[model samples]
Target: MALNSGNGTVPDSKLGDEHVAVQKLQPDAKIYDRLMTLSGFFKQQYGDEPEFYVRVPGRVNIIGEHVDYCGYSVLPMAVEQSIILAVGTNKQRAQLELHHLDEGKFQSFDCDLSDLEIKLPKTGGPGWYSYFLCGIKGIQEELNDKWRPIGMRIALSGNVPLAAGLSSSSALVSAAVLATGHAQGMPLDRKQLASISASCEQYIGTHSGGMDQAIAYLAKQGCAQHIEFHPKLKGTPVTLPAGSCFVVANSLVQKRKAASSDYNERVVECRLATRWLAKSQKLPNWKDLIRFVDLQEACHLDNDAYVKLIDQQLKKSIYTREDICEGLGITEQELETDFLTPSTQHMQQFKLRQRALHVIQEAGRVVKFRQICEQLQRRSSKQDIEQLGQLMQESHHSLRELYECSHPDLERLVALSAKQGVSARVTGAGWGGCIVAMCDSVKAASDYVNVLKREYYAQLPAHLLERYQPNDFNEVVFATFPSNGAELFVQ
Candidate 1:
């Protein structure tokens, strides 16, 4: 519980100039409480004190959704809410044990380090520990039998809302990667960890586009990140507009993305749309171009030009299998094999136009959003911030109308936000999650939160209504400030 328990450290790294920084713990009371509680649980479960702790923050996308796999940039900020793990090495029989603070919701899971595997359910996604395994296995795959990871005992405490738009799951995965890699003394930088964590989530059956994992490691304390994935994994910090505050409000409607194919289906649609447009334009390498950003470069078209091409070519409500096969000069078997994922193989109809439009346009909004933020950074203006808000409104409309990822609960929150003169949008994979709203000032955010409480949170279903407390309302809605990325705390 003491801030001055001992010295913490960043793992040894010879390949990079900068790794995830390790420093002495600062005196923050809220964080102190979470760590102290987790430490107690760790001792009770593992019969020993923790060697160190890992802190990985969840993120809220400011603008741009569902475009990272298509090689586009995203603007997301790391929030203070995080997944903290108290980790200790277990030299006894090479075993991995995981204990969750909320034992009622998440049961414990253990296995041998040599036999690590993620067992997903037949219907819904895997349990919370499965994500942790993804991270550890990713590092092991990188090692490729050259090195074996040490055993570990971990106790996790997280405040990030589960199955919400925030990157709670990604944060957990990143933490595991960090904890494992560091505990074994691997020289992995934030960029390396981000990339590995992003790819490993595919093990859990959700096709993440790397934005969530990138922000999980690259985020700074006071700025939003413009995370680019096309050229390379890089994060450029963009200062927010003056007097701006981001407020996250949960809809209380949770849907595990891995439970269904909705998230992967969109990824497939974008690929299909890309190839269809490429072939229609008589490009020589149509089959190879599966991302819009690459297609734009191949055609020498700017964002607007590529968007116009999509408008002209992908004018189909539903492109049946035969329709696409004849157009692409491929057989039905080839189409199923090349274009669709295992989960999305059952699809007969494809909304290529709408899904492609949302991605291309939302990517443009990301660029414009970062541009407006840079402009405000030079000269503070109310007009520029409002322009940014308008772009968010457009992005939300695109997600709803074109992407079809917005839920009715999300729409209700959006309508309520509009009534209060705020701009809000769905943040994550977005079938059912949280809505992020932008307010002009702290006072405005406070008033907005109060309004949301009386109008939205108070009228929840009976199950959640019984658990409500007036003073502990942050879990439902809160004004979030940008926070630092993953860190290591040792004792």
Candidate 2:
């Protein structure tokens, strides 16, 4: 199953373009064969050669969780995993077919540019398929008459974890939009593609702030982008300092909110909070409240004159818990059971605090981290990797304490990395998912893995240990920067 032939081998040309030199997260021979077979079928069915391979990556939020929806900047990067779509175009009808590699199923929908009601099946469950369709639909809606309905066959394959806060759904939607745009011969650039996908994927019910799709679509190899979404979609890729290695560890605990059950409700709550805050301040929109301030202006919230002004504005629109619950369409009991606390009440309250604090602090850290990285990129004198490390440590603490995304396994992993002299934090949405650690050196990472294999494996849940026995230090991964976004393939 050579779906991605250059697995684990970095391409020399992947430095600065829409080319990703990443390892296939789950390179299955059978799945790859199924996907390629579908590609062949499309070629045979539509009489068009398979174009280039396009892979949109699944992202990891390094320091920010649930903050993007608050209209704040986020530190996230497209990981070395992606949803690979092998696509080709047809001149005949306006339709798109998705060939599922895992289930050996083919699901598709004919494109009706005028009819937005046509729905596609969500692969993971209900409304999932429609999200994928919505990306295409959004693009079609934008193109109007210039874009014709072109047929396409997309063979999906990837290793990005689903429902673990890794943006798997967003990747799928973005990949589909990319493939469909290419098939239709539209002039949709990377940013436009990302914006379209984000807007449509939002229809799937999560009021996401467009970070995942932006990183997935505009990602570059060897660089982590610092993205600000408020005033405009502006980003600059910050290069990593030499001798730095990143370790991403999956905690293997899946939370219920990630799937179709209760995740959408939390999004609603955040939106309600913003709207309430906006009205209290008498602002037209919540985006008006988002202000980019200097380091001095941001230090104190209560005493500082500027902070007082902002606080006064927010305090006016502060809603009671009941009001928030009603706006989000949930009862207090439902909120207590489903929204407020997924783990425990104590844990949930702690998480709400953590989430609020992380957004404020992390929005500040992004500027500092980028400045430090930029300084290192130019002059070798006075490198502040320690500052970056300290910020990462603080960010992780806020994530663990205030944001409440960190699980015990993630905490253990971070602690292990710290013992080995590495700085680490929970990546993505946390609460039993992956953690990204910045190792002092590759040797330090290796040492951490060796220690973790001895200590962490035995502590796993009995069910997981029995079904998937821990291999001492076996699944730990180390990677660097300069990854690509999606590309087209023709064969």
After superposition on all C-alphas, the RMSD of every candidate to the true structure, in Å, is 2.9, 7.3
Q: Rate the local accuracy (lDDT) of all candidates.
A: 0.87, 0.61
lDDT of 1: 0.87
Error of 2 at 300 (Å): 15
* TM-scores for the candidates: 0.95, 0.74
Error of 1 at 108 (Å): 0.5
lDDT of 1 at 178: 94
Give the lDDT of residue 434 in candidate 1: 93
Candidate 1 lDDT tens digits, 379-440: 88889988988999999999999999999989999999999999999989998899999999
Cα-based lDDT at residue 142, candidate 2: 73
